[model samples]
Target: MILKTYRWSFVVTALGLVLAAWYGLSAHLGIGQAIALVLILSILEISLSFDNAVVNATILERMSDFWRKIFLSVGIIIAVFGMRLVFPIVLVSVTAGLGPIEVIRLALEGGDPETPGTYGYELHEAHPTIASFGGMFLLMLFLNFIFGEKEHHWLGPIERALEKVGKLDYVQVIVAGAVLLVVAETFATEHGRTVLASGLAGIVTYLLVNGLGELFNVEDHVEHEDPATTSAGTTASGVNGPSGAARATGKAAFFLFLYLEVLDASFSFDGVIGAFAITSDPVIIAIGLGVGAMYIRSMTVHLVEEGTLAQYPYLENGALWAIGALAVILLLSIEVEIPEVVTGLIGLAFIVASLISSIRYNRAHPEEAHVEQHHAAQPG
Candidate 1:
């Protein structure tokens, strides 16, 4: 029955294709060519993103079943609408002086709406700005992944320090705000503006969502933690879960989703640029890439439900390191001429090698195979 339910993956794949076709129809792409493009892009995206799904599963498996379901449903909306749709429009708005409606039209048309001379000129025109935004974005990701702090901050020393400074809380807030403003004012470059606006948007979004979460205290999907399973399993307090394992897992899944979104955006950066390299038509690009995004999502859920990551832990780590490498490539692309398809191939090679290694590792580590079977058989 679990596997039967998971078969909804096919339905999702179908839905994505349908949407891509619709976009193609609106844009006047020939139906046959549109279908072919969608299929190719979908396969490419899915193959490239298999590692991402494994990484996600490693975290999502720990969430409560209810929360996992909610993640599958609601998170898809955020991925499709927020990242796939709204994000591109934001890029257009920031770089092209176009309002959202016109931006939507441009994307639907895949930039083919304008005359060849004008559309091609505008796209080339926006390349510098797009490259700038993408470059900084990828650099931040690389640094954060390779060098950023990874410690858990649940009531950590920083929080303790904040508590101690409660007497001067207003002063602390003011100082932090002033420091940020000064940095933004001092830079005053396009890159600087991008960083400020994006970072502030992120912080505001987090605060708003967190405030609501606390207000609602939605605990219906919280799971019982298991200590034997996780490092943080014994340390969590409150209704955090039984052993802290579940809570830690849920938290990790939330962040992992964020990381995947970032990676997806990065991948899209190159794909979008490269699509224009092929043709300036925005419809073909949308249909192709939209279908591609769908397949990636489906593969992610499949890898999770099938426990692929657990069956191959080294593969999971390898995929992460590969992602780190790709982050570097994306940042480098801001100034350099690395091909997006080449970057994709390298990432995919890492995942495929890892998959092979996982198969070999599982052959040697028979106990892991048994454990996965046991877990797979457990009732939700």
Candidate 2:
């Protein structure tokens, strides 16, 4: 079933190959170079976003079948086009006051990568604002995950201690706000105000999206007062039938969907910006990132179907830490340029360590893993 679910990934990847060939022909690039670059881009995206896939799987499992389909389908469109294409255009349009046609021209054909005049080149000029917003949102995501009371921990004492700190009233917001201020102050005078404004906006966006999702979830809970139970008497979502989780409609699901989109966008911000390093061509960037995103969605489904998260709890912990590191790097990038490879490696390192840690945990606490697996069988 999991393999079948990834059929779309195969299709998208095939299309990426086609697009890569066409791009190479147009750019007069060697065929080998084109395919190689695409492959490299795809691999880079997968490496940077594997943690994203795991995090998404956790959220996607709780969603209804309808919402999950929307996640894989409509969500992919947004990830590919919205962030990869239109978002950059909008950013350039806003920063440069350029028209749509002009922005497209600038993005695709304008100045060389090394010099000004290209959209890719100009995008960095607004890096302070972009990084501020994206960095703060990512910071909140990281803070919430690490600060939450998790069921399992790879680093027991540290996570347990953080879980205790999570209980403090408004701790997430307070700490995030303080961190944002500190980062904003580091920005040079020319962009300090802009950075602060963008950072605050990012914080607000996270709060609003999260608060709305929670409010809608409360409504969903009220509407479905009677939760279903599994054979072992574990709790489940009432709407889910035998074949699948119940079709979760209503305002709650709607808000949750929006929250997820925003969350996904925040995760994608770095990849989109960092992509300019490899290729200045927006079309290629979109194709490569789109292909990569589809696989991520497929991998997410695979994880859910295989119950990877329940079996390996520390994986999510590592993803959260990686997110935290990325956020910090983004903040620092406001003042200094950090290579995309470094960011990818940092995340990959965390994931690899988490995998090893999870394996050790599974061996040491096989019974605990079994218990988690049993609970995982219940529909959310």
Candidate 3:
């Protein structure tokens, strides 16, 4: 099953390596050095985005098969080309006050990254705003998740307390707003207004997407339930079957898809900037990171299809915590430079700890394990 799921990823990896080799040969970077850099960048992307796959799986599993397919296909295109390539160019263009064509020309010229006029330099200059926006969006996601009531609690005491606090109205929003305000004042005094505005945009974007998703979801529930046969038919059509149990579809699915893409964009901000540290070559960076993204997509589908999230319930919690850590790191990084390795390792640590906890929980509660396995075994 693993091999089957990762077949396309393998193919993409091979193709990416081939492209890297060609670029290396043409650019006189040496085939081995170029291939190695691509491998390094790919590893970097995977390490930074491992938690992303887990979070994506949580939402992807709740989507219908058709939309899931769309995520892997259409979503991957947007992720690879849009986020990794065009998005950076757009950022450089907007920040440098250059046209898109001019930005493309500058990127192709590929001067020293430290030089003020270079493509890498401009992108780096835009990092504050990028970090502010992505950080706030991710913070909102983390806050919303932790603040929600859940039957399972990985970090029991802390989660319980947060859940209690979550009962208060708009607690997540208030907390996020406060954090943004502090970050703007303390860390980003020079660019305070820009940071605040970007952060607010992030908050508003999250609320809009999440609100629309919920609104459509309620409509879906209403449409699924027949007023005349609310009890029997509602269960049959909306609560019991494979398609039931909080799965997203139609307009709800579209919003979820939008959320996923934006979530992906936020996650990619760090990777895109960090890629320059390895090499300033945009083509190589794209090939390498794009290959890693393919693997992430495969991993997400594998987790969903294998019901890994269901089998290891705490995994999602761990991923969310990792996201919270990343959000903090991003916000902090606006003032202080945080290493990419630090971010990756922190997230990896959380995921590993959570996986171990999940295993211990399963061992301690075999009945619950059996029930999860039974549900997973059922056809979807």
Best by lDDT: 3
Which tens-of-lDDT digit does each residue in 1-380 have in candidate 1?
Answer: 34554455566657656765775576676666666776675565565555556555544555556556665676666655665456656766656777777766665444442454234445544544454444344333322222322222222464345434544534422433453344345533445565455435433433343234334334543455444543321110011222224432344445434544554564456566665555555555555566566555556656656655555545554565566566456434434578757877887887777677767766987986677555544444
Candidate 2 segments whose C-alpha is farther than 4 A from its true place: 187-190, 219-248, 374-380
Order the candidates by TM-score, highest first — what do you get?
Answer: 3, 2, 1
Q: Write the per-residue lDDT of candidate 3 for residues 1-380, one digit (tens) a residue.
A: 88888998899899999988998999889899999998999999999999999988877766778888899889989999999999999988987889999999888777778998999899998998999999999999998888886657999999999989989999989999999999899878987998999999999998998777666765463224222211111110011222225566788778878888999999999999999999888888898899999899999899878877777869888999999999999999898989999999999999999999999999999998877766656555
State each model's CA lDDT, in order. Answer: 0.51, 0.75, 0.84
Clashing pairs in 3: none
Clashes of 2: 3
Give the better candidate number (1 or 3) by TM-score: 3
lDDT of 2 by residue, 1-380 (tens): 75598999998998888889988888877667777777777787887788788777666665676777888889899988998789888988888788888999888784555687778777877788888888898888887876775656768889889879988988988999888777767554567888889989998998887677566665353223123421111011112122123323566567666766776777677788888888777877888888888888899888877767767768878877888898888888888889988998998899889988998888998998777677556654
TM accuracy, model 1? 0.65
Per-model TM-score versus the true fold: 0.65, 0.89, 0.93
Candidate 1 Cα misplacement greater than 4 A, ranges: 1-9, 12-28, 108-222, 225-267, 372-377
Sort by lDDT, best first: what order?
A: 3, 2, 1
lDDT of 2: 0.75
Find the candidate with the highest TM-score and give its number: 3
